[model samples]
Target: MTQSLSPLKSFSPDSGQVKVWIRRLVWKMSIATFLLMAIGSATRVMNAGLACPDWPLCYGQFVPTQQMNLQVFLEWFHRLDAALIGMSAIALVGLSVWFRNVLPRWLPWASGFALFLIVFQGILGGLTVTELLRFDIVTAHLGTALFFFVTLLTIGACLSDFQGNNTANKLPWIGLTAASLIYLQSLLGGLVASQWALHQCFFRGDMCIVMNTHIIGVVPAALATLAAIVISWRTAALHPLIRTFANIALVLISSQILIGVATFKLHLQVAPLTVTHQAVGAALLGSLTLLTVFALRDRQSSGQYPASKLT
Candidate 1:
C-alpha cells in the first residue's frame, strides 16, 4: 500500500526539544547499562561465564545448535546485552557530536572514552572465558563493567539540565569517599566469589580471609553511606536531587547488606540471591554517581575547579 506523506507532521524539533530527547536517550542507556551488569552477574552466578567457551559466538556458531541449555542461554544473552550496550554507547557518542553546540564541550570526549571502555569490556569478557574465569581476571571484568556503568551515569548526569548548582551546598567530598568505599568493597567481594573463598569458608578457614575482610569492610562502607545521606538531607533545601540520590543509595546499601547475609548463610549457592546482591551493588554504584554529579562541577576554562562551576 502507498500513502501520501504530510510535510506538516515532519517539522524538525527546536534545539530545546532535541536536547530533551538527547538527555532522555542518555538516561535510558545508563539504566540499561545498569541492568546489563545485573544480567552479567546472573550469568556468572549460574556458572555460565564460559557457557559459550568462545568470544562473540556460541558453540563456534552464531547460535548454539548443539544444545540450548540454560547456561548456554544465559551466556548468549549476556553477550547480546553487551552488544546492545555497545550500540547505545555509539548512539550516545553520535548524539554528542551532532548536538555539540548544546552539550558541554567535554561531552564528546567523555562519550568517546565510554566507547573505549566498551571495547575494553569486550576484551575482558573474552579473557574471562578463555582463561577459565581466573579470579583476578574475573574481578577485573566486574570492575571494568562497573566502571563503564559509572561512565554512562556520568554522561547522563552531564546531559541533564535539571540539577542546579547550589552555593549553599557543603560536604561534597563525602560522596566521593562513599563511592570509593563501595567500589573497593565490591572489588573485594568479587575477588572472594571468583576465587571460591566463600564456598571454602566452612572447611578452608584460611581461604576465608578475603571474605572476612569484605565482611569487615561493610562497617566503614555503611557509615560512609549514612554520612552521605545525612549530608544530602541537610543540603536538600539547596540541592534536592542530591538528597534523593542519597536516600536511594541508603536503601540500596541496606538491601545489599541483607542480601549479603543471606548469600553468606546459604554459602553463596543460591543463584538468585547472588544475582540480587550484584544487582544491588550496581544500583548503589549508580546512586553514588548521582551523588558525585551533585557534588562536583565541570573543570573551568581557567583550569580551576570550583564546586559551583559544574552547573
Candidate 2:
C-alpha cells in the first residue's frame, strides 16, 4: 500500500501518521506469516510436526537446546514465529481500537477478526500435534494460515493509495473469483501433502482420490488466473499496477505447475521442490488478492463503486 486510506485523509496529521505505522506492521506481519507458512511446510515434510511433542514448548523448555536438531529446530522456529505474530496481533488490535476516533472505524474490527483467525490457527496448530498430525487438523492449520494471510493483504490494500482507469470495470470481481479458486486449490494441495496422497497413489496405489482431486483442481485455478492476465494485457488503458500483479500471478501459477510436476515426478522426495510448491502457491494467492483489492479500491475511489465497497 503506497498511501494512507483516502477517508483517513480527513483526519489530523497524527492520524495519518498512526495509519502509516499500523500499515507497516500489517506488512511486516504479512511477510512473517508467509515465511511462517513456508517453515510449517518444511516442518511437515521433514517429519518435524511432532518433534516438540508438546504445545507451545519443546520438551518443557523454551529453547530446548539439548534436544535441538534439524527437525526440532524447524518445528521450534515455526512456533517461535507464530508466537511472535500472535502477540503482534494483539498490539495491532490495540492500536486500531485506541486510534479508532481518527482511523477508519472498520480497522479495529478487521484487526479483531485477524486476531480471531490467529487464535483459531494456534489451536489448530496444537491439534496437529495432539492429534498426531491428523490429516484434517493439519490441513486446517495450513488453510487458516492462508486465510490470515489474505486478511492482512486485504487490510493493507485498503489502506493503500491506488490509481485506476475506466478499463478496471469487472476486473476486481474477476481477480476475486480467480483468488477464490486458487485458495481452494491451495487447500487441496495442502490435503494432498497432509495425507501423503501423491506418495500413496504412486507407491501403494492408495489415496488416489485425494491426489486426483488436487490434479483436477489445477484446471479452474489456472484458467481463472490466466484469464485475469489475458484480460489485463488485452485491455487498453488498464493500470500498470494491475498488469504487474497479474503478470506476477501468472509467473507464480506457472512455476507452481512446473514445480508440482517436478515434485510428482520425484515422488515428493525432493524437499526443496516440495517446499517451493507450497511457497509459490502462497505467493500466487497473495498476488491475486492484492490485485483484487487494488481494483476494488481503484473503482471505489474513482466513483464507479460506492465508498463503502472499499474505504
Candidate 3:
C-alpha cells in the first residue's frame, strides 16, 4: 500500500493545517530533489549516464535484471528518483488545485511552473543519453535540475513561518546576486565535469580554458556569498532564520571551495570527492536561496514592492 504523508495521522482539514501540510510536503520534495541531483552527479562521476542506453527504461525493460550492475543501478535509480519527483510535482499541482480556495492563488501557478521545469529537465535528461552525453546537453540537464530544485525551495519558503522585517531592505538583492553567481558557477562546473575538462587539462593539456573558467568564476561567487553573510550579520534584528541561512551559506561555500580544490588536485579521479563537490555546491545554493526568498518576503511585506505583492 502507498504510504501517506508522515503527519497524516494528526492531519486536520483546517486551512492552517493544510498550509502546514503542503509546506512540509514541499520541503520533503525539496530534499528529495537535492538527493536526486546528487545521484545524477554520482551517475556522471561514475560514467554511468548512458548505462541503460535508452530513455525512461533500462535495456528497454522496466528493470534490466541481466544487466544490473553498479553503473546500471546508478542510471536506473537516477531515472527512478526523477520519475518519482515528477509524480510528486504533479501531486503538488493537484493538491494546490484541489484546495484552491484555502491555499494561496500562486501556489498552483508556482507548482505548475515547477512541473514545467521538471518536464524540461526530463527532456534534457533524455538528450544526455540520446546525444551521447554532449557537454552542452549534460550541462543543460544539470542546470534545469538545479532550477527545478530552486523552484521547490522558493515555494517552501513562501509557505514557511519566516516573518518579514524592515531592518534590511537590500539583503534580498545581495542574496539574489550571490545566488545567481553561484548558479552560473555551478553550470560552469557542470560543463567542466561533462567535458572532463580537469582531466584533459591536467593530463592531455587540452580543455584548459573550460577548467580555468570554472576556477576563475569561483572568485566572484565566493565574494558575493561572503558579502551576504557579512551584511546579514550587521543587520540588527534580522529574522533569526535569515541569519541562520546566511551562516549556513558561509559554511557551505567554504566547504564547497575545499571540496573543489580537492577534486581538482585529485584530477577528478576520486568519484566520491567529485560527487561531494557537486552536492556541497547544491547545498550552498539552497542556503542562499532560503536567505534570498525570506528576505524578499520581508521586503514585500514591508511594502517595498508595491506593484508586485506576494501572498
Q: What digit string (tens of lDDT, one per residue) describes model 3 on residues 212-264?
A: 99999999999999999999999976777788889999899999999888888
lDDT of 2: 0.89
Residue-wise C-alpha lDDT for candidate 1, range 29-123, written one tens digit per residue: 77777877888888888888888987878888887868689999989988888888889889878988987886678988998999999989999
* lDDT (Cα, tens digit) per residue for candidate 2, span 1-311: 43767667766557768878888899899999999999999998899999999987899999999999999999999999999999989999999998899899899999999999999999999899999999999999999999999999899878765656556778888999999999999999999999999988988999999999999999999999998888878877666777889899988988999999999889999898899999999999999999888877666654332222222
Q: How many backbone clashes does candidate 2 have?
A: 0
User: lDDT per prediction?
Assistant: 0.79, 0.89, 0.89
When sorted by TM-score, best at the front, the candidate numbers are 2, 3, 1
- Tell me the spans in candidate 3 whose CA falls farther than 4 Å from its real position: 1-12, 302-311
Worst lDDT run of 10 residues, candidate 1, spans 298-307
lDDT of 3: 0.89
